[model samples]
Target: MMSAVVVAARAWIGTPYLHQASCKGAGADCLGLLRGVWREVVGAEPEAVPAYSPDWSEPARREDLAAAAGRWLSAESAMAPGVVLLFRMREAAVAKHMGILSVAGDAPKFVHAYSGHGVVESPLSLPWERRVVGLFRFPGH
Candidate 1:
């Protein structure tokens, strides 16, 4: 079941980054990529997502993305395939970035739609591993 998410997420690789967009292959942001995967694996989005800016533009303590992910996904204590990773880009900033853990073994990796880089699966490097503030699993899995 978790692999299903990885499969779906991988299909979006090469998608150009587009803020507030969710159409795979066309464009998507980090949240958009997650939302698209959720729709494919979880049936439909639990709620509509309102427009929001990146961490740099948002207030330092405003954690809307984490709050929403908490509401729709089950919290997890450890990283696992298909689990969502929430990242706080910098100290004191909101956890505004998100990605699905695509690989969890020796060469851990995650699939995310990065600004300017689009949707790409990158190694779970130390810098990224450090900023992770929360881990969550899609409901029922």
Candidate 2:
């Protein structure tokens, strides 16, 4: 199951960043990447995502992304393979970035699609760890 998620995420590698998009081999944003993985690993999306701009939660300063994850996914105490992660870029910014923990160990890491980098696996380094605002698990089997 974990491998499935990783592989599915990797498939999005090189996809161009397109806000609110979620199609593999075309374009996708961070949340779209996670949504793609969710469909692959869990099933259809739990709910329809509303049209959101690139700066969806910045002005509101609400943890909208984290709140939505809490609504649809299970919480986990620590980083685990294949778990979803929500990040708050700044103290006052909303949690917008999303990723999946791909390696959980002494050297923890995750995979996310970024604007310029496309989909890539990254280390959950100090800066990244500090940004993590919430963690969630895929429910059911």
The TM-score between candidate 1 and the true structure equals: 0.94
lDDT of 1 by residue, 1-141 (tens): 558889989999999999999999999999999999999988888899887765434655667888898899899998888889999888877788999999998889999999989999999999999999999998876
lDDT of 2 by residue, 1-141 (tens): 566777777777778888889998788999999999899888999899999878886777766788889899898887778778888877778888999888889999888988888778899999999999888888762
User: Where is model 2 more than 4 Å wrong at Cα?
Assistant: none
RMSD to native, candidate 1: 1.6
Evaluated with TM-score, which candidate comes out highest? 1
TM-score against native, each model = 0.94, 0.91
Q: How many backbone clashes does candidate 2 have?
A: 0
Q: Note the residue pairs that clash in candidate 2.
A: none
Displacement of the residue 132 alpha carbon in candidate 2, Å = 0.6
Clashes of each: 0, 0
